[model samples]
Target: MKSNRMVLVFFILILTLWGCEEEKANKEVKTHGAYTENNVAQKMDKEDKNNEKTAKNQDDNNSVQYFIEEEDFQKFAKKGLNPFGQEKKQINLSSTDFEYYIHGMTHQKVKAKEKWDFFEMHPKRIKWLLEGLEKTKYKLGPDKQKYREILKRWKQKDFSTIVEDHNFIWDENEGTVGKATDRLSQEDEREYLESEYEMMHHFK
Candidate 1:
């Protein structure tokens, strides 16, 4: 009987120890699982924030659409092709439109040898040009008086005589309108760059 009692006590002790070990193992597994879940959630949250930032940046970059309008060009056209007309009837173009216009006309898309380079600019640039007459600036020099007479003659024929024609006017004033294209002056270059940067980044 004494040996049996000792054997029973040993068996109970072994079962208690096994139960504690099993509970400890289960608690460790639960803790590890919670940690893994937390890590995954944090990673997902970080990715979501990055995605939002990317989308916001894209939206900021594409906020403004640069395109010329026919009505605006027509308004500029009503001011005539001469320097006075150009100065008085300046086309209200945003910086983007101006950039597109300047690049679209001068840059050649095709090879250097090609004479007929494609005008692969935005369709708006073409629209403003096809409307007949581009925006220009007035000059304060001896040419001003000369331009005044030329403009008078241009208006005399109900604006029918195209100054672009060499035969339409004096040889000196033949390409005068073409020469006086409206461009951002040297002083405005810095302003344009700063505005462009701000528009892209939304900087203060």
Candidate 2:
């Protein structure tokens, strides 16, 4: 009987140890699973934040920045309208700067096709410049007067009238100067006229 009791005790102890080991293994599995899930969640959160930041940066890069100074504006206003080159170096300028270069700088004869491209690329800037010319006050001068009349026609979107006046200027006729405005009545028109007009007589 004593021997039987000893065997029974030993069997119970083995069972208890096996149960404890199994419980410990279960706990370890749960901890590993939870750790994996937490790591995956953290990784997803980090990716989302990175994507948001990238999108914000892209938006900032897409924004447009154009700057124009008074000296540049005056230089352009005096130069009258001229042809702008079709090179990327020219086109890469901001819309406002592009206008200054086209109207302010002198260039060799520009093809009608190139002018058309400029128009197509910067219609808004051109319109804004034309409108500004109509409203801004200028010093007393004939050149200023002629430019005012040209701006008037341009504001009306009358390309034909501009061409006609340009022709008159080409013919060296004083009559091309429209009715004198309060501004620029005292200054000579010679200063405003382009020294070298290279545009074709008419756009195609």
Pairs clashing in candidate 1? none
- Best candidate (score: TM-score): 1
TM-score, prediction 2:
0.32
TM-score, per-candidate, Cα-based = 0.34, 0.32
Error of 2 at 174 (Å): 60
The residue pairs in collision within model 2 are 140-184, 140-187, 141-184, 141-187, 142-187, 142-189, 143-189
Query: lDDT by residue for model 2 over 1-204, one digit each (tens)?
Result: 999999999999999999999999999999999999999999999999988866754553244222223454456546653222233232233433433333331111211111211121123434544444444443324554555565455444333333344333333433333322221111121222222222332442
Worst 10 residues of 1 by lDDT: 109-118
lDDT tens per residue, model 1, 46-81: 999988866754553344233334565567567664
